[model samples]
Target: MKASTISLIIHGVDVDVVYKKVKYLRIGVYPPLGQVRVSAPTRFGHEQVRLAVIERLPWILRQREHFQTVERQSRREMVSGESHVVFGAAHRLQVIEQPGRERVEADADHLLLFVQAGSTPEHRLALLERWLREQLRQAVIALIAVWEQRLQVTVPQWTIRQMKTRWGSCNPQTRRISFNSELARKPPHCLEYIVVHEMAHYFHDGHGDGFTGFMDSHLPDWRSQRRELNKR
Candidate 1:
């Protein structure tokens, strides 16, 4: 019997199922988890593949729900009582009202945020974000110096900015690395791992076996730090 392909709409999203060679039916979704792809062997017809995907539909819905929950949780916009990351540690800001200038200072524990007596919450948040970025810049430079020596690589330029998704990115062609400014709020090891990861890219452009080997040899805990960074 000749196998056929089919397409169907699941949860208002279109999914295409294909029949290929030498494989049992398999279903998986991409990052946002709203769509599923089904692949099956030539011996199996599209109907069978569709049924398998239908069976797994509940699991897919659960995965999508989980993704949405996490996404909502990760979008912290710097409000009072909202947690901010510093050196990978979660710190809640203590918003203090002041009579004059807006200022930010850190004590042995929490970040002390002071704003002009009449200043609004928005102003205070902006001031704090600026201070955080400055701290991040200093820390990034320090980490770069350490890794340049440790990895025996030279990075010509680097920038720290707030990135919505990725913690860091590197341009191997230009020897420039850009790190998410929010990293300053995370743990020190997280910063180090990101710096090292970008530095490693200076040597290996792709995340292949060579890249993994290089990272493993240089920083054995790199994987753990990466996991922790993402978990937050």
Candidate 2:
């Protein structure tokens, strides 16, 4: 079969799907695994595709479960006295109402949540969250610059925001990357891992063998950093 032709069994029936531009198609089944693709084309058959994708239905189900686990793990309500990660270190938020200051500050060990004396708790929380996001954005930009030099890749644009399940995603076509701003709270290495991971996508658009090889060749400790990041 041509590389563009994809075949699989679904609902006790075998189906073949083809892509007009795809030059290769490969599938595999492994533990804790699902569909890991490296497609050169963006278009594919829809109806027959359903049947083709069903061969990995078990893996897809496992991936969904893992996604849910990560989603639950990433939830953190910004609250006073709650412990939060900062640069991979744990710190407690200390709410303080001052006479004049309306900004939040992070000291060596604690996040000093300051607000106007008459400000409501909700307002204080909002201010703190916004401040944290700004801090994360700055850190992400700095990190991206450092990695762009280290990896010899250029990213045209990127954004930092709180993501529900993914640490980051890369749009090869646009040469843009989006990272979970929550990473600012994680360890510095975690941030580096994400930046490098996205940079790799610039060369290999998908998470395939080539992607893994690139990561291994560039950062041998990537797996460790990834594991640590997930733990947080």
Candidate 3:
């Protein structure tokens, strides 16, 4: 059955309540920003769900604090000496103001941003994001080639966007997929795992046994990669 959802504000935090046919209530804090979600048995009312969230309030607050720390890390100032992530490694940013078109370049431990002398932070960010998108695109294309054949599915189209709460999503009917641009900041393996994961959705709709089996058969270490990718 499809779960019914209700939205609530508890102690200044937004909570999404999903009523499911389960015996117990489950709570989770998700990322990009701290989003609290609760899975409650269908028999429970909204009051019961609220109480459940209050009972676990401390733990939820801690989890939200962790996500805030991660958010601050991702929100950069676009200046020299600022720490930035590229391909899962921390790279210090160096803004080199010059006379040409703005471009982003990086070595093993540093990101060299060449701007037009007086570029604003927004302009620098735009340049960096443009570069990151191309990086993610090339990686996705190569991975899709291998995965489409292995999974026996064709991805008619795919896109990269700034998703606040999801690493990736897919439309099985359209045979199209979308990946989070944030994946560019993660390891290559993480991106590969997401590609295979979304592609597998063409066969299975949810994370049920069918999807689990598919992932297990194809990528045995997917759980580890998931943990790494979810880590801030």
**lDDT string, candidate 1, 28-106, tens digits:** 6543324455667777755676677778888877865776676566654544676666665567778777687678887
Which structure among the candidates has the greatest TM-score? 3
lDDT of 1: 0.72
Candidates' C-alpha lDDT: 0.72, 0.68, 0.86
Encode model 3's per-residue lDDT on 1-232: one tens digit a residue: 5456667998887887877678899999987567788888889999988888999999999988888787776677799999888778889999999897778888899989999987888889989989989989999999999987887778999999987667898887898899999899999999988998999889887565677788999999999998888876
Model 2 lDDT per residue over 108-178, tens place: 77988767666675676578668878888888888888888887777889988666546788887998899
Candidate 1, position 223, lDDT: 89
Model 3 misses residue 121 by how many Å? 1.8
Clashes by residue pair, model 3? none
Off by over 4 Å in 3: 1-23, 35-73
Per-candidate Cα RMSD to the true structure, in Å, reads: 7.9, 7.3, 4.0
Error of 1 at 54 (Å): 17
